[model samples]
Target: MDADHLLTRRTVLATATAGVAAGAFPQTSVARRLRREPFARAGTFASGVASGQPNQRGITLWTRLHDIGASERLGMEIARDPGFARVVHRETIRAAAVRDFTARTRVLTRRLDPGERYFYRFFTRTTQSPVGAFKTLRPPDSREPVRIGWFSCQRYEHGFFTPHAGLAAEEDLDLVVSLGDYLYEEDSPAKLAEREQSTGDPNGHVETLEQWRAKHRLYRSDASLQAMHAAHPVIAIWDDCEVEGNWAGEGPSSGPSPVGPRSVPFSVKQRNGFLTFFENMPQEPIGSERFRIYRRLRLGGLVDLFLLDTRKYRDPQPCEDATFEGDVPPCLDADRPGRKRVGPAQQRWLTAGLERAQATWKVLGNAQMMMALDIAPTRPVGYDSWDGYGAERRAILEQVRASGVENLVSIVGDVHTFFAGELHTTGRIGSPVVGTEFVGTSVSHDGIEVVGDEQQSALVTDRIVLSNPHLRYAKFGVRGYSVLEARPDELRVDFKGVRSVLAPTSETYLLKSFRVAAGTPRVRPA
Candidate 1:
């Protein structure tokens, strides 16, 4: 590698040094900060409050203070109850200008117990935000049922984030997992105009840091997204839309038919985008790994969620010579042993983590569908998914089969469809169902819109099941998310969606429910 390439590589792997200015307020100023009447009502916490990257002892608390005046330390209060009578932790945290006036901190307090719920809010000298809450992760050996809501692929312009409003209202959720496509990067003049009807987001493709921040700001401004975060702590493993569509590591779109506008050099845009993500969201330091986002979160004693980064370090799209989109040409390179999806380090990390996990359930928080969805008889393969890289996918599945994991579940998104299927050593049957996958549909992105009636929906669902035997349930052309409930012996998922996105409404209904028993490798109606 050239010296520049080598330096950029090092920067990517080095521990992120993102920082805000030192606390401008003196220690005594905290008392005054708290005493001031709450000023920042809805507009101050416009982006909203969020918590993520949780471990046994701690979780990160995030909020972006709109303080253009000067740098200052904000007062924060976290309590076990809404009354604030049982205050767990209180401190002064700084919102640094270097971090774009956003304050994100990894809070580790000994007094805070694991497997518990806590509420948090921020206060400046003049204002206070809405009280948001999150639960600390349980010890891996704790034998309690874990509740998680999995969601992905939301397009703000497409419709209202109504599901988020519903999800926030849910009282029984422990946490939420965003699978990917967190923000849509494709913005044109027309699309931006339509999106502005909801919030003020910059129109056109997101290339610069300003534009990226604008996009994030727009998404966070949505009451639905904010409500979801305010309701339950969410840990997100971003997919392609985090940067550009179908983007692999080290560059923008590749292959013969790449989509989206070409970005700046891989080093610049990747660094900015990744840093913006950390600054904007409730994420901990990525350490020396740079842009890599594959990490593990231990939830209680029964669940280990390995949030895999499928987009950051993947090899180029397979079959560069093929036609665009759905075209599958005779590409001999897909099965090559060296074609990588999660890169070498991340793959090793996930494999080792899964093998070493003692949790009763190892939940792979994948951003894309793990199962192979054959378009078949017309077009055979999909380049953007696991179907493109056959060798690496099977390698993971082979380990799943050989490792004898009691309960391995992969929850995925990105297809804008809902599917509950068995994970076999291969895509075909008789390959041994080693793992199971519950694929949630989009949050607001368009699904199969043609199926507008009950008959069409049934027909579409039947065709999918008939085409893929391992797929027990399939719902195409829907916009919603899934709630995953994991116990020692069984895992149940409820596919919930809204009726319409064109209009603003919060009502959502359960479209389907499936339960997967331990060691069964099949999904049955719940």
Candidate 2:
């Protein structure tokens, strides 16, 4: 029988068994344990294991049991050694069919030591999960240097995940940050196709809850992505593609609806997308606000990472245009005072966090580009990004400047190109620089070349750099990730590019490096 049929059969059998037990024993604790014991030996850990949301005392670990008949209890272990020789903690966790057989748990304070490296794994009676490792955050007063690897925009059908493999091999990385676009909701057009056809993957959009779950499963099946998650703890946030392209969280479509006008409502689709995302990712469980993802993480006294949600609480894209081209001119609606990108509440939270943060470096884990980019003489592009909410952007920068926050830097993605620039309050050519922004290239998504050929793409990039004086460097048509090293006196970023993602494996090299000295808001070649 097919997998779906098998699942249906198992569900029916489990339900029948549960009803009989409840009628016989009045649903006591002992009866509940007995009901779950039979399925403890039924499944395999196909999705591997992951750890994330690292704090000084603990971290969250995740795993999924595939091909299971019912909810099962599993053994979890955390150790200081990869060989499991120094086991420190052990517990029992459950993988429930209600959560698609996925199990997530947190090992928090009083159980683990701070600023230490630990390994973890999950196991059933017959099968064992691969061991994953994570490093806990240092003490708040410590001045340790932190290394982070960040990337975004990995459409499964676009190319291979060689960048993930590269990141997994980095021994010095403390954690990996996924800015957004972990997976695409739908396949792109044919002309941009890059993956091999022999893979036999489905080609269309996903709308239903089951389809979204299956999409997450397909993406998790990637060995390289699994390896990266296993190697380091991740801090992740979602962008537009996580649900639908150019989707607004509040109401209707901001630009164009990927789902037909009469199909499922935007709210339902958003819930499905958020549910699957939480089920698959290694993060905290959803709470009162079901879709809340914006949060903050602190690494010692050196870095404060604020991961933002640019999609969930924002106004729709202004001018009703989401096209990825620069042909559209600047619209007056984009400059309206009330237009919001991060929404009012989130803006207040971010500004308050910035004002009170004691870390030496304030890093914004932004999903989209923050620096203004002008494609033509007077036509600003990327209205879907910070450019669409000029008033809010200026207000935030003005707060940063007036409050005298030092060493502010934003690491962003979703543009599929590498950019290092200075951010100004008004986004003018010679405006006072308030911070530095580093936009990393995508892992495998098509860059500017998707719109034009190599020469034409280069010409457009050149024009953008020349038009924006605050921009120190820009590179078009590259596929790779970036690494940021934070120290007490300076912050450094290195853009690493892959030779090709069409192949299963490719060589990676450093494209460029830039740095900003403490208290200086300008970016310079390192």
Each model's lDDT: 0.74, 0.81
The reply for model 2, stretches above 4 Å from the true place, is: 1-39, 189-203, 261-263, 285-287, 322-326, 450-453
Most accurate candidate by TM-score? 2
Q: Tens digits of per-residue lDDT for model 1 on 129-214?
A: 78888888887668889999989988888877877877887776778988888888776333344465322233356767766777
Per-candidate count of clashing residue pairs (backbone under 3 Å): 12, 0
- Estimate, for each residue in 67-177, the C-alpha lDDT of model 2 and write its tens digit: 887777776778889876677876667787878989998888666877899998876655678889999988889888899999999977788877888888887687899
User: What TM-scores do the predictions have?
Assistant: 0.86, 0.90
- In candidate 1, stretches whose alpha carbon ends up further than 4 angstroms from where it belongs are 1-43, 188-194, 197-203, 256-263, 321-328, 377-381, 449-463
